[model samples]
Target: MKLTREEITAALVGLLGADSVIVEPVRMDPYLREPRKRFHQPAAAIALPHDVPALQALARWANEHRVPLIPQGGNTGLVGGQVPLGENEVVVSLVRLDKVRALNAEAGHMTLEAGVVLETAQSLAADAGALFPLYLASQGSARIGGVLSSNAGGVQVLAYGNARELCLGVEAVLADGRLYQGLGSLRKDNTGYDLKDLLIGAEGTLGFITAATLKLFPMPQGHETALCSVNSPEAALALFYDMRRRAAGTLTAFEIIPAFGLDIQLRHRMLDRDPTAGPSPWYCLLEISRPAGGPEGTLMAALEAAFESGGVDDAVIAESLEERARMWAFREQMSECQSREGASIKHDVSVPIAAVPELIARGSEAAVNLLPGIRPCPFGHMGDGNIHFNFSQPVDADPKAFMAGAEPIHAAIYEIVVGLGGSVSAEHGIGQLKTGLLASVKDPVALQMMAAIKAALDPHGILNPGKLLPPSP
Candidate 1:
């Protein structure tokens, strides 16, 4: 009952037109290339279904043939979930299905196809006089379906929530080609099982997402942005608490940046000019979203309070839109700036807000002890307790030699993170990058339950095979 490559291509051409099927390896290269370049296996063929019905048909045929299919969108996922794992798999690109089904700004919702780009979705909401509010550096290329599938969390997750919370409902095609039409703009629904939630973050193993109903919010009048100078991580934590008590929900983003970030930016000339208040051991980029008819200067007043109370050394509030953009630029370019420094080890982990200070302090000591003079750039989403704890390669050291010692560095930091009850992956999911770490860190009982669910949903192991769930012990 096995289908050869020729037969699989013939069946795909039968369901969809010949133009929709790609069998040549050279032509299918773009679909296989992911952002990370970590996964490089070639797919059997790349299938581009032009419509939802065709996609469902292909999925059903693939399921019956025991052929693996990887659902891909803009191909912008940092994790390798959007690319193929083996030559036996095929990638189904969702680009052609991009469309806006409906938009109701007053009702605060919109229905969109899975293939719509995140930036385009933001533009659509802006045109309707509302805000989608899920902003990421990859928004220009990241698709709605991939965003929801990964349950991505961006900077503003401190206020709004992640992609899962923003999605109201999803319509997906199951493994057997049955359409699960669950799209709606309902604010409250006491539904059974919460199937929509299950499929949102399933990474296409359970089903192929076709469309979704997403939540929107009223446009903020403006934002109060500031760059603060702190002597240490403990001071940054105290400043965050002061800002939270003062602004509450309006305190949308509180990101930490180390002094090395600015050094790299300056050395690489990544910024047009200096954006910080001055020099300090640490910097915190704080933001407050001002609602309609709300008072301004709340962020400035809170910074002044922190300054007087010795929580912050100095601060620079953005006086113009250009300055605000520059401050954000410094924070957003932290990851890219590290690449310029040479080889680096990165971990996106989160602990309790109260434990963040300890996580940073203990983690820094461990990495420093393991490798002397290893620059630690521990920053990001301090309000969410998610720090992108990355270590820059030691100065004047060989990149290969530095990377070879990454294991001990990772082990040391993860030990501190686990001891503090933190998650190894704060935003990025368990793609091919973190499968080994997941096996070691995840609860045994939870892993068993996940295996059972994966077995039931993908009985043939054809959908995104060898992902998320580790192999049974």
Candidate 2:
């Protein structure tokens, strides 16, 4: 026989004090509310362990009782990964574990506790005269543990790589309460299978990430940002290739935005002023980092070459830090601005950087074919080809009615993505949001391997019971 909610709460409170275990529904409200608001099921209780030992104790207690425990950090994930899946589960929040365990800028890495906010981690590196280089829109509230658990990829991924690459090592508590102490700052270790990679993007299905050793880069002397106007996705792609060829690894970000995105942001007053050079069919926000003692005008020279070659229609280079912020604000506020317009369906998908134009063209065309007058807002990391393919409600359409018609649009988009060798869930992990989609599109052999590994690590299925992996075939 299994324990009831009351019994589970009592057991958790026994491991952690009553102050740490929140059984009341009202007090658990904050942890329950996810950013996307898609998954609404309530968790039985919220467990806020004070440190690693307390968390291990709580996990051990829950594992023995077969009580599902959902590990959460920051609670800022777009997919339903960080939220409760069912009423029987308990959310183990690492928010109280915020700490900077170690910082060694000279050695090019830092050890941070899971609860340290993403922005705080960046600031810590900046204080040490280094750069963390994992720039995310939700970094202000997204914590280290959740970021690593999700294996987040943000704007600077073109050069710095994703959360998985940026993370050198991790410390996690397994489903059965054993801690995996893999936090080593070494660059090369060919001893055995990479357990850190397994846990980084596991979405709490196998273990709860308690801390991480993150790779850092030398702080750039300055940044050169530009918003270039392009006539079409093809032109944007050409420009991206040109920029990459010219700037190479120095090219930090290459984000593409549609006119629809610009319209929504301006309408919502999300930006103080327009950041683009002028109106066009599309815009590319490309940036380059200036290394210490490096010559200026590398980005400008590249842009000049693009203009000469007719790859860019027009461009506005950020002359000041304020201009740079506004330019990035226009890019970062893409998702929030869509919400202001009304109901929008979002897909965090990716294709090859070269195939981006085809993906956007076919995806948008399919979406339009399915629903006449559907507004497509295909924007985001063009350098890495991860577009947040989103669709806004038709003019004057009811939000509920529009959302009701999301299935066909999703099907059209995913079919094209898979056909073109693109990913259905690019930056966002296969949380509850895309488990069904993952099953349909992911390779059967890959799924089998995932299930086998999951079974090996979390035989009890007590950690994030219904997330990431799908039901076995």
Number of the top-ranking candidate, with TM-score as the measure: 2
Give the TM-score of each candidate: 0.97, 0.99
In candidate 2, which residue pairs get closer than 3 Å at backbone N, Cα or C atoms, i.e. clash? none
For candidate 2, lDDT tens digit of each residue in 1-473? 77888888888878899999887778898899888888878888999999999998887887788889999999998888988878889999999999888999999999999999999999999999999999898999999999999989999999989999999999999988899999999999999999999998899998999999999899999999999999999999999999999998889999999998898888888889888888999999989999999889999999999999999999999999999999999999998999898999889999888889999999999999888999999999999989999999999999999999899999999998888899998888888888888999989999999999999988889999778988666
Off by more than 4 A, model 1: none
Candidate 2 wrongly placed segments (more than 4 Å): none
**Candidate 1, lDDT over the whole model:** 0.89
Best by lDDT: 2
Instruction: Summarize candidate 1's per-residue lDDT along 258-295 as a digit string, tens digits.
Output: 99999999999999999998999899999999999999
Lowest lDDT sum, 10 consecutive residues, model 1, at: 464-473
